[model samples]
Target: MSSRGTDVEDAVDSEVAAPARGTGTRRRVGYVAGLFGLLLLLLLGAVVVLVAQGSIAIPIGEVLRVLTGQDAQSQLSRTIVLDARLPKVVAGLLAGAALAVGGAQMQTLFRNPLADPFVLGVSSGAILGASIVILGTSGVGWLSGLGLVSQLGVTGAAVAGAAGVLLIALGIARRVGDPVVVLVVGVMLGYLAGAVVDMLVYYTDPDRLQALATFTRGSVRNVTWNELQVIAVSCAVVLVLSVFLAQPLNALLLGDRYAGSLGVNVRRVHFLSLASVAVLSGITTAYCGAIAFVGLAAPHLARGLLRTADHRVVLPASALIGAVIVLVAEYVAGGNGLTKTSLPLNSVTAFVGAPVILWVLLSGRARRQAG
Candidate 1:
């Protein structure tokens, strides 16, 4: 062949050998779209099912009415649906979403699919902080005498406690650089926090103890509009922070060394990730009381379902999945269809999360290091 003809043939062969980059980009976009669509459907379904199944048994019509701000048939009914049930549902939805998103970040940061917002003993620390406030102070003139500022002090303490554990755990993770080692470190921290809580409870006055114990078991029933406001402000702030965090977290998934090579500050990512986890876990634990395993399992489920480890995909997917799991859990825990007495939120979650724990361990994912 002539030289010009040979060059032309080689160019044709190269074009035929590999597809255009645009095709791969289009495929990724489609996959993301499908996962997002699934997430939306699951979120909507969860809202409907949970709203329909609460204790007072509001019909789906009334539930919709309340949600839409339409009048109910009776004043008591209106109050129940609008004021009581609505807040509980909203709280559950936010709590679930926040925990799941936080969990996803934690898993990526620690490089352990099993790592959750709670795993670093942050939740336990919050529980301890809240317990001290509730059990040691509520019975005194303290709660009655204190203004909203003082009341927030307790919640603030819970947040600080959670943040403290997160700082410590992240420090260890940075120093150690092994996911399993960090996981063990987190477990020990949690146990230590629990032991401290136990000692405090033993020393605490009996009247205060009763009120404080609820902080450990988790409950959605105590949510009033006042407390909701605090949760609202905090959740809003943290969630926005989370949205900005997605890209950095995704970079980290490539490993600290690779992320650093890409001009991503590994230390800064760790700092932000831990801070986000602290706020996310702290606020949820403060209100919900150490709800277990939602964080640990939801991200795994989201990743497995979407078949992608990218935080940009997994973060939002996990949030949607988390909301669904908790809403379903709330119905199960709330004595819908199965029994009269409502089961604890922790109990229902354990049933869902326990198997995930087993899988992480048995599948060797839990034992693997991020490095």
Candidate 2:
């Protein structure tokens, strides 16, 4: 690694380890447990409110009945809750958790606070892959007009695209051995991928663009239960895998050499972590259309609230916070009955993300490490 990289790792290691050493174990445990409990309750409340406040306006009681497998007062209410809002709400939940966990892993693996699938170009690659499939098939019709088989093809293409960018980024990072340079490279790759996508869009028939449009702005409303199965299975497996990597990731904070000395296979950890991030991000983007900022912002918020950088704590906390962020953003972006016209999920997410980016820049953490 470069001197700058080493310096940053040392700084991060100290900052991450100090709090754990200084605090009382019981007090920290209690705080973590309480925070987790509050987050779960908050998540539940968000789900209830989101389900209750859509266009049809189901009552909270009725929403609960539908959720708990009880009968609703009306068939319409049950249908709306079951067939319409429930899938969307669940999609938001899963997408948020997936992105946040992916973000947390990216930050650790790259040792860059700003690192994420969206910023690092992984999402763009997925977009490009999906676009190719969508536009290539536009000779027939838009994605919505296509059958389930074609949709699966698009999802597979997206995962391939994400994996492509990930491999390229990792290769360059290994050669450069500099976090800042890798970050810049990732950004450039994203732009390159985006430019290619734009060129494709420019040549394609405008009618097919309707389906492609949602791929850029992000949305969970259109995800069907079938797509949810793929997302749930992929995210669940990767999330559980992440739990196993927590200790190795913690060891890694101390630097690769030290981690190796402790018998952590740095190479194996990197492979697994990168693979997990690629899968989490690629799948989410394939279904949700490249949602942004949740992956970048949620981890920081988790670390701040928990006052630790341990992946075990940060990972789950980030997932919960991220889910809440998306759900709330969804509500703001026309999930509420008040808005007749809904905005894109990205538009709402940017409001939350831009401020966080500004704070990270103004805090001089990145700059200080680079210097």
Candidate 3:
């Protein structure tokens, strides 16, 4: 063949052998879409089961009907599902999603598999902020009697405390330039926050102690619609912000220096990501009482199931998985009538969370990542 003809043939072969980049992109998009659809279905099924299993024991069909504003089996069924169970179910869903998203961000930003809102002591800071208000104002009225104003006050306090701790952690992280050192620092900070909270509770009036204890232990059963509005608004806004963070966080997975080289603005991204975590974790801790390991476990589970750490898939998947975990825990922890006495959410969450922690450490993911 002539030289020009041979070059033309080679070019044609190359073009035939390689897939178009757009086609690969579309295939990935479709796979992610299917994954999200499956997760949404699982979350919906969980919500139905949780709503149906409470003291009233409505059927899933009745629960769905009531939710859709259609007729239930009876007016009483409607009242039970709508007026009573709906708020709690919704609270669990929002709080779970919020915490899980926060944890996923934390893990990526810190580049530590075990990083989470609770581990960083953000929740403890939130609890401390809440305890100060609750215990400080005990003479005025118990938390149950304090109206919307007090609710808002407590929520504000929690957010402030969480943000404060987050900033401190990030500052230290910047100084040390070591994820392991920063993780230890965060744990110590959490201990300090916990100590402060304990001391505040110790001096608190007996009447206020029970309420404070309940808040610390965590429960969604008592979250009223009024409370849900605060949680829903704050969590929804922050969750949307987290969506924008996905791309920046994905870059960060390659390490800060690499991410910075890619124009990720490492410092700014860290600030924004940590801020989102503060809002999500703080508000959730305020309303639901440090619901525990959902934040830590859900993100890891999402990554494991999806087999990717790409924030786009992991973030939403973590949210759905977190929602399912919380709903399931609520059901098992006496959100259902299967047990006479209700258990705190942490009781069940610890089951999922503790194992994951051990696995991460034992498998050397943490050591390898930190190294």
TM-score of each: 0.89, 0.90, 0.91
Give the distance in Å from residue 249's predicted Cα in candidate 2 to where it truly belongs.
Answer: 0.8
lDDT of each: 0.77, 0.89, 0.86
Cα lDDT of model 3 by residue, 1-371, tens digit? 69999999999988966667667778878887898898899889888888888766887888888889886779999888877888989999999999999999988877777889888888888988888887777434325767788888888888889998888887887788788888898899999999998888777777778778888888888888888889999899999998898998999999899999998898888888888888888788888898887888999899988889989889999999999889889888998787789988889899999999887787796677789
Each model's backbone clash number: 0, 0, 0
Query: What would the TM-score be for candidate 1 when compared with the true structure?
Result: 0.89
Model 1 lDDT per residue over 1-371, tens place: 69999999999987875676667778878988988898788777767666666556767777777678787766776777667765766777788888888888888887886788677677887777766666656554323434577668777778888888888888898799888899899899999989988898788777666556555767676677776787878887887788888888888888888989889988887887778777777777776677888888888898888788877778878888888888778877872645667777888898989998898787774456542
lDDT score, candidate 2, position 173: 81
Which sequence of candidate numbers ranks them by TM-score, best first?
Answer: 3, 2, 1
Q: What's model 3's TM-score? A: 0.91
- lDDT of candidate 2 over 1-371, digit per residue (tens): 69999999999999988887777687889999999999999999999999899778888999899899997889999988888888889989988998999888888888788888999999999999999998888434335666788888888889899989989998998799898899999999999999999999999988788778877889998877877888889989998998898899998888889999999999999999988888888788888888989999999999989999999899999999999999999999989989789999999998988898888777876678889
